[model samples]
Target: MTLMASDTSADVVIVGTGVVGCLVAERALDAGLSVLMLEAGPRVDRWRIVENYRNLPPSMRLFHWDAPYPPKPWAPHLETRVAKESEQYLQLEGPNARAYLQGYVRYAGGATWHWAGICWRLTPEDMRLKSLYGVGRDWPFGHDVLEPYYTAAEYAIGVCGPSDPALQWPPNAERSKPYPMGPIPFGPGEKRLTEAAARIGMMNLPAPQARNSGVSYHGRPPCCGNNNCFPVCPIAAKYDAATALPKIEAKGGKILANAVVYRVETGEKNAVEAVHYFDPNKVSHRVTAKLFVIACNGIETPKLLLLSKDDRNPNGVANSSDQVGRNMMDQPKLFAEVELAEPLWTGVGPVQSSSILNTTQGEFRNRYAGAMFRMENFARSPLGSAAALKKGLVGKALDTEIRRLSACTARLTVEHEPLPLPINRLTLSSKTDWLGINKPNIYYDVSDYVRRSAKEYTVPRLQQLASELGATSFQLSPEFLNSDHIMGGCIMGSEAATAVVDADCRAHDHQNLFLPGGGAMPSGTASNSTLTMAALALKAADAITAQLKHG
Candidate 1:
């Protein structure tokens, strides 16, 4: 399976066969371009797919609370050198230093394989954070420009939700039509919270999701409602990038699995000419193509660019702007749990069914703050829930408390925007991995704005909502203090000095090279990033097609 440098060339070489890469390949094929998609993971076998139920060990499951998790068999060879944990704070150096944060995902479909498909479009204000809120940088393109692309992505991926008429926050764009599928069923906990929020003058509605509730347009079956959406979808109810790879293959694009792209080979003018990768059997291969797209998640994408050092571009490939790996940001999450006076069914549907815009504006807006609270669906397994209950309620009568709290428990999650800081960034370390490439060193710390915003603004609002819902005892989950939604690093902007890609998603230095996914996001909004990432990929695909047609 190892493909060497003498491997066949392609019209377009896509590094990383994730959702974005697959979409890009599909678009390339549509434009009459032959595509070769390189994936570091092995080809997926449907029979080998395991159910992500709570019975499995945390390490095997996604979203587990364990460090030094066992690396997947197909993990990139270059990733072995990544520091496990450093005593001294390691500062990154070099032009692409900012983009070196440690990120995971070596599977063929990437992180989407373990993602919760809570879909929400970035608010219009999100695109112009600097112009409107005087914080963060404005996106080169606004929500208006991405509306059409968003619609296309929605249909392609089969989104489910009703357009909110309230129009708060960034507000969704004018949809070409409604969601391909209907909203997921609201659980009893969501019903109680929704009713309580509405009575207290709060706007609560069914949160838009990418999970299938019924037969979807794409011929995918509805979600089985196993309450396990994070790790793996046993029935493919939730949208994963794997769903799109077949479509790309059907369109004549070739997906080369078990191919780990090590670097982007550039020519005399610093333009990428081919992607250098190693196959499963340690065979080195080079895929020459007219265009190269890097969608290897945020961390690896930047790392690959930095590793592609050449005499012409001494710093790295597409490092002329020195913004390849800067502005690392992850939405820090805060969770608040409330025990309602009346018992409510804890699990009956998707984990998050209803959301409220309690603090989307006002003083929080001026501080570049994110949303305050949303009614999260409690989909934790019995074991995990038992662990949560034990942590929050500590008393002699533990058994009695667990029995009483099982039916009435409810949790709300607050997603706050992390302020992009230069010091908290990614860089290449001296440590070398099996591939002989330096490991990606990540340094991340939540900003004061994020900490203060969650404690001062969000926590209070959540408490007040719980009080209004006639809750007896309210406790916040300590585990939620650190956010899971990771973004930034390789952000898109108008200038090469400030951003990695242009508004069109083309690398500033190399016109034919593109980088998509969370890395391209200028700012991580309150909503889930997968939808936005897919939308941006569609937009980039269109731009690439136009350029190919014109040239």
Candidate 2:
């Protein structure tokens, strides 16, 4: 198939039609800028989405998994080098290491199609990590600067929650408006845990989720509370990028599906000129734009910039600082399952309904930790519940154990703060994809802080709580843990050497190129990254609008 061009140019061109990209497109259109969005997946339809979810293999039916689809011509092969088991403890290379991690949605709606809809705001201290804790570098701007944008994003997405004083951290920002909807009602399991946590001097509160509890302002229906949130939502109750695409289109923006962006093009002075993309048939096309925004996730965003190398910029486009793919970080997540002594009603509502703020503070403060416990209701699916029981009980005694403790299983989730490690990074591989563009080679490893925090600080406290809650037994997963909330790889800072983009999200070397996504986060916070990504996009959009008007 031959590649064809649409209208010659747009005011802004965004790559990746995921949650962040859709938010950026909508904001740009609202600013009266002509926008074009390129997605590497097929257009999504409601019926097809349901079918796709139903077809997923049972093993891969987790909330983060999306339906299988043909990969774009430029997509990388699923094969990669796996680190040896002996090297796992090296803190750099290991058997579980992922050579290329690409988790973005290929469908028109992106990953939001199957997300659990947990929305959270990064604590104020999250903004100045380097300055406050001397760990990760500080963001050029603080939470104060992002407060208004956060308000805008929450309202636009119809978030539901009440501000909890206990969960509030230092350097807090003011909210200009309230949540668009009310919070989800707490289930019996959550109520028991909340009461238990408070009895133990822990502050437990309802989780602020993006799942709608009532008619949304954006025309989507309320959530049906179908225990299945991952893989894909059969109903449009959860907020997804698709909901925002229509608003962008209404403002005259264009979204092109199955368009895989390869690399950015630069002019004589190294100014961003255009973005090159390959169609499903592997035919290359170029779209010129006054400005370009890379909303591709953490890994692909830097990979694209690195592959745009030329004689003028040997390292790559906007590589003067050599920080495009450095400082990679993902949340250090831990899971603990406890068998309860009584029936707490484990099969209702979303799995993660409430969280405790006690272990998140004090000596663990520097470690950056938070614990969220959901009633085992997430395991309502027969296959999922049986798997959990088997994994927890172990051996041929599993059947006897299931009958012995049928009503007593609850799970606790602990998300630890993962600081950005300069050594843990992303680089371009010599191997090229079908479009002749280099693939991304990710080098990620958990840090000592993450390991110690999970073992010393998080686990002990969780064990104490489980015992207090009358848990007969408890077990923890051994995976190092990667979160749906991927961040860094294109960190933002005041200086160019340590960061790729500036406080406003513009590339340090090329002012016309903006990176609006979790990739620009200086450090991964304990919250879901989608809401924060939208807020940052809104801030960047405002900056872009101001620059265009002034210039």
TM-scores for every candidate against the unseen true structure: 0.87, 0.88
lDDT of model 2 at residue 280? 72
lDDT of each: 0.69, 0.70
lDDT of 1 by residue, 26-46 (tens): 777877877788887766543
Candidate 1 regions exceeding 4 Å error are: 1-7, 51-70, 73-104, 167-173, 384-403, 477-482
Candidate 2, residues 252-274: lDDT per residue as tens digits? 88888878887789988778999
Model 1 TM-score, 2 decimals: 0.87
